[model samples]
Target: MGVLLDSFGPALWLVLSPTNLVIMVLGIIAGTILGALPGFGAAQALALMFPFTFGMTPEAGVLFFIAIYAAAEYGGSIPAILIRTPGTSAAAITVLDGYPMARAGKASRALKISLYTGVVGSIASSFIFLFAASGLAWIGLQFGPSEMFAVGIFGLSVIGSFFGDSPVKGFVATGIGLFLAMIGSSGFSGLRFTFGQASLLDGMPLIVVIIGFLAMPEVFRLMAARRGDDPEVASLGGENREANHVGLKVMRKLVPTMVRSTLIGTAVGAIPGPGATVSSLLAYSEEKRFSKHPEKFGTGIDEGVAAPETANNAVVAGSLIPSLALGVPGSGAIAILLGLLISKGIVPGPLLFQQNGPLVMAVFAGLIVSAVLMLVVGIAGVRVFALVARVPRYMLAPFVLMLLVIGTYAYHNYAAHIVIAILIGAFAYWLETIRVPVIPIVLAFVMAPIIEANLNRAMVIHGGDLSFALTRPITLIILGLAVLSIVLGFFRARRARHESAAAKENLGETP
Candidate 1:
């Protein structure tokens, strides 16, 4: 309590400062614009902001990035509600009902509800971070290399959810990603998959590959399919003005749903894995299950938009709990933020609050301010951003390509990196045709290094004894869970196959 009181003044003063306030609003504006654009994400938006923040004070830079992170998460729902296309994976669940509402000529109402819920969730989650982060930091310090390895495995276990339809394809995609991660040289200075290319020494540029995998395929698909007509864009201008505003009565009814989804989002985010994508989906599912009229869920319902939008946007603050309290990141965007903090010499752990108390408080203050800014900016800009839906594929495509090119170059400034992005983008585009989404691959690529490095260290610590690595209590528990999950997943798959075959046989006999 004393520490909190001491930090309050510094936090408030920094937040209200002329420079930080201006930068925070600017970051929110950039975040909303980026989030409104399909295929753009918080990590990419932060990457774009990186070069600019490089010269600022640590407080200023961190504040700018935090605003962007919070706002972008909220921003993703804008496109999702206005059109079927979700701007980020975090907003994917919103499309189920948001687009439906838009189709029903209530795009403005959907956007307003989304903004309202986003701010509410953001505030709720921030309170959790404020009060809980310190306590969580203790658990974070207990992690060793072995424990981290186990955590990575647990993260990988989410492959079942990623490939809920076909475990084989999911594993295949994961294998591809792991193989890609192994491309660079060993710590002992031996090359693995370089194939004699000098640029391969660094393995692959993650930013370039990510941009390529996400952007190129979509671009190629758009060009080849010539998505000449987007009815949502044309229809936005014709939405009913009277139905555009969400009524006070309607807002009152969604209060419970908002609270429930915020709690779910905060819980999901506090854990090591199961990011915003899962949070929003779980919230949406729970909302539907508990609704008096479940049948009305997918048919332009306000609760549908509210639940997912609230949950996902809440993930921004919820995710920060782990990132600030522990070195472990909550999501890919947070992973990037982790790297940024390390580069700037701001180590995150139990000691972070003790050592950098004011900075931490400033971040908390920034998050609250940003949430308010996101709501205000979103309300004012909804009509303007709705204009994005009307953008022709021909115009949007070239502009996105240009941004991708620039983003890819911004990483290490290597020309060869740009070429690799081109090749990977082209490959990912073809991969999509086979119903193989690149998400599993991307997720695996992100974790492969963490798993490999940690596992190696754990073995080395125990003199190369595999059993010795498994002896620690935390490692043992996590690895046990990972093994149990894998076994369960396998059994479930077998059972599903058997049931499917029996159903097929029965259908054949019935005919």
Candidate 2:
């Protein structure tokens, strides 16, 4: 306890410094702008800012990134509510109810609810991070390669369930992502895949691939949909509508939903894969199930806004559990953070905690401060962010595309990477039209190499005996869970179809 307290003191002091405080504030503000803008996301924002952080101390650099992450999760909801366009993929669930509320002239109320829920959820999860992270690290230390591979498989399977209506499409996307991951030089053989071009010798850069597949495509899609008409701006009410109107009563009413979503978010975050999108979707569904009047959910109720907002924001801290403890990132933003950590000569496994305990504690402390900063900035600037809804899509699209191009090129200073990004963007656009979920593809790309390499290593160590996978208790348990998840997903889909049919019959009879 004494050692822990001693370690925490430096972190606490570091976060309290005026310079670090300014960084946090600026990061949050920048993240909010990026998140509120169409075609910009946390991953892109972080990737764009990576070069700028190269000169800072590792502690300050990481804190800056965390601030952006925490703020962006909340900031995405602004556009989600005001424009029916999710600024980040995690905000997709928010649009279900948030946009509806805005159309009903309750945009300010909905935004306030989301901001408050985010602040509370973040604070709650920070406690989880402080207390539970060490225990999770202990458990992670016990995991062998077989168990790790199984965990990766479980993550890919969960992605299938989380994506849209078609599990087949999701799986296909996952398979493609895995195949893309195989393009790189193999660790064991040092051989490249399908490489005729010399430029492919180094394989695709993860940052480049992510930026191309996720960010650039969205930019193109937005540009394609550009129009000349000015967007209608929603006004935050005048003097009577003081920001403080988001009071204790509202917090009291939202407490149950907030707590439930936070728990769900934390649990999902602790999982090896699947990130904020899954957490938000699950929380939204659970809220719908427990609501007294389910019909009011999508029509724009406070509960609807609270559920997804709280859940997604909570994911900011939750994702770090796997990344910090296990050397695995559960989301794209964390994946970028993992790269940044690597660049800073910090390995993410157990050694990270051992070698840089104070830095880790400082990161946790920064997260807490960032969350508080998000609330302060969000409340004070709700009206300003709402104004972003009025930006012309034409102007925004070009600037976003330009950033994507520059960021991708700067990652390696290779014109080939820029061309690859454009090509991937076109391919992604085509894939989207076919109703494939890009999330599984991204997860598959991230996890495939990890799974394959670990599986091979485990096999080699076990004298090539396949039974080694089941011989390990952790691996066996994870396999069982994966099987159970598939079974449950099948039943859920069937039940949903039955309910749909029954609702149709009832409507026909009543008419």
Clashes of each: 0, 0
lDDT of 1 by residue, 1-511 (tens): 3586489688979898999999999999999888766556798788778888778888888889999888888888876675454567667567767878876667788888989998889888878777776554455456667877887786566553334346667677777878888898764358899999999998985556556665666566445534656664456545577778777888899999999999888876776555777678668867875788755766789898999888987887777777877777877788877777887899997688788888878887888899988888888987876565556555566766676677567667788888898899888877878877566676577677778887788878888787854578888887787677566656656776898899999999995
lDDT of 2 by residue, 377-475 (tens): 887897775554445556567776776677667666889988887888788878878777665665567667668877888888998888987789989
Which residue pairs in candidate 1 collide?
A: none
Clashes of 2: 0
> What's each prediction's TM-score?
0.73, 0.71
Worst 10 residues of 2 by lDDT: 230-239
